[model samples]
Target: MNPKVRNLSTEVLSDNWYILRKVTFEWQKKNGEWQKQSREAYDRGNGATILLYNNTSKTVILTRQFRIPTYVNGNESGMLIEACAGLLDKDNPEDCIKRETEEETGYHINQVHKVFEAYMSPGSVTEILYFFVAEYTKDQKVTEGGGVTDEEDIDVLELDFSKAMKMAQNGEIKDGKTIMLLQYAQINQLIKYN
Candidate 1:
């Protein structure tokens, strides 16, 4: 059955580096009754995020940074391990992912294997994140990779596949996106398991 949409309205909630918009809509029930609901959302476009791995070296490139939300939410250190990701601004997913990988890790990937597109938080936010995996080598040079001043203070972390998997299992790596990427890599045999 098709969903009957009605009374749709959108309101701007916040506009910064990313804009948040609140959307409301109504639907008709099977009995022909109208039901209304609202959701607050933000869209940074369908951005691309990458899980970069050096298969030869068995290393996965990640970033560690203090997250304000995490800190406020009772995390002692608030440092989060995450895959390199950024919002897509007038660029395609492939280009965005490549650029983000370079900006965050300074690795220029020759080939990026598409993993899957996922919604970070569909119930509230409208962020559709594209996940990818790229192979790199140790010869690749890395630049200082923190975001701009307003969002700075990121530290690049390189970990072996085994260690990364262990960290995830032990709850040291708690970021959803990063967890998803690691699981994808493991399930697809992109990262060798002991």
Candidate 2:
């Protein structure tokens, strides 16, 4: 319903893994001229991510996994340290994140605070990610979480809050969502750093 756009058309390019489509449309520029444009967008559905922090222990939970995309893009190991996250496959954002957290981190947390929502990549990917934060305790560790699926080989790590921040600063943690949540924790004083 954008007044500046019209004659929109989309053609599916690939549907093997997820949906990818070529979108063509006419957009009216500020000069009142209509310009035709086309762009390919990958639709992987929306997802949610959470940062699990322990204020008492001054620690946070993270996961390490091998990502094929990063491996192809110059990451030598292809292994990435990131927060627990998953796509919202027919569930609400809150429920999806909770399930992902338990499956990926082994912490069955009941309370979560939604921090924000953002589009991780807008130009080529159409995924709006929901961000969240939750407090964790030692008793919450119910399992040795390494992901439930065969395709997901994840390593869960518990590190000091300051060390986690340093990892993000030094590029050890390259995941955008994980960095953002760490920054959010620092900005909001979620954990005290000595």
Candidate 3:
């Protein structure tokens, strides 16, 4: 509720997968005139993502999966390499990311350092993504994680931190969330590399 906003309403356009809504509202311009506008927004709920790093080994864990949206948007292979992430269906950010990390990467991390939260796509998507990083050791692996659902076919990858950064620089790692986490690791010196 802002002083500049009035006459707001929302209409559900679709609810097949998650939800798509049409929002109509009126805004008071700086010149003191009211303007009406309508926009479509997709609400898939908030999500959390985590990057598993080994400081001593200078390595990081990532995941690969086929994304239909990227495929239709001219991604030739449709396979995307990204940090372990999932929608927070019924859990808080920390708990949800821990569950997702173990489910997708097979590493049962106990403590995660929350770096930041951001809206990945604010234009039309109503999802705020929580980002985190955690240290991982060989003993943390509990299972051969490839997701618990039949619909999720994920491949876990353990890559050198430097090589992963190179992948991001060369456009091989195009996912925004993954790239952001990688950069964060580099900037924060999560692992010292020469």
Candidate 4:
């Protein structure tokens, strides 16, 4: 809710997987003038992402997958390396990350610490991503996580935390969520850089 703006009308442009709406509104200017405008917004439900780290091993788990949007935009391979993440459908953020971690990476992990949450793309997409961090040991791996059959093709990668950070810094890991989490890990001292 904003005091300087009044929402007028909205029209649904697409509502298949997620809702996309075009909204018309009036905003009061600083000089006391009213301006009318229209903007399209995407309303995908919020999601959660987690960084799985092994303090003893000094490594972290990440995933690689094909992202159509990235390919369409400019990426030649259309593949991206990202942290374990999923939409918060019926479960809370914590539970969603736990499920996603196992489903996408095959690690059955508990005891996650919520780091922070953010709106990934505020200008258009209305997706608030909840960020989390959890410690993982080799024994907790219960399945060969590569995503569900015919659903997601994910390549699970366990890399040295230092290498992961360098990849993020050098554009090898281009996913924003993954980059953010890796930086957070360093700033918060989740893992020491070599």
Cα lDDT of model 4 by residue, 91-170, tens digit: 99999999999999999997999988999999999889999999999999999899986968999999999999899988
Clash count, candidate 2: 0
Instruction: Kindly report which residue pairs in candidate 1 clash with one another.
Output: none
lDDT of 2 by residue, 5-57 (tens): 99999999999999999999999999999999999999999999999999999
The lDDT values for all models are 0.84, 0.97, 0.97, 0.94
RMSD of each: 2.2, 0.8, 0.8, 1.3
Error of 3 at 98 (Å): 0.5
Can you give the lDDT of residue 181 in candidate 3?
99
Alpha-carbon runs more than 4 Å astray in model 2: none
Error of 3 at 139 (Å): 0.7
Whole-model lDDT, model 3: 0.97
Instruction: Give the winner by TM-score: 3 or 4.
Output: 3
Candidate 4, residue 180: the lDDT equals 95
1 or 2, greater by TM-score: 2
Instruction: Report the lDDT tens digits of candidate 1 across residue range 1-194.
Output: 44699778899988886778888999898899999988888776677888888777788999888888899998998889999888888888888888787777777776788878988888876778988998878666566666655766778889998899999999999999999999988888886655
* TM-scores for every predicted model: 0.89, 0.98, 0.98, 0.96
Against the correct fold, how does model 2 do in TM-score?
0.98
In model 3, the Cα lDDT at residue 1 comes to 62
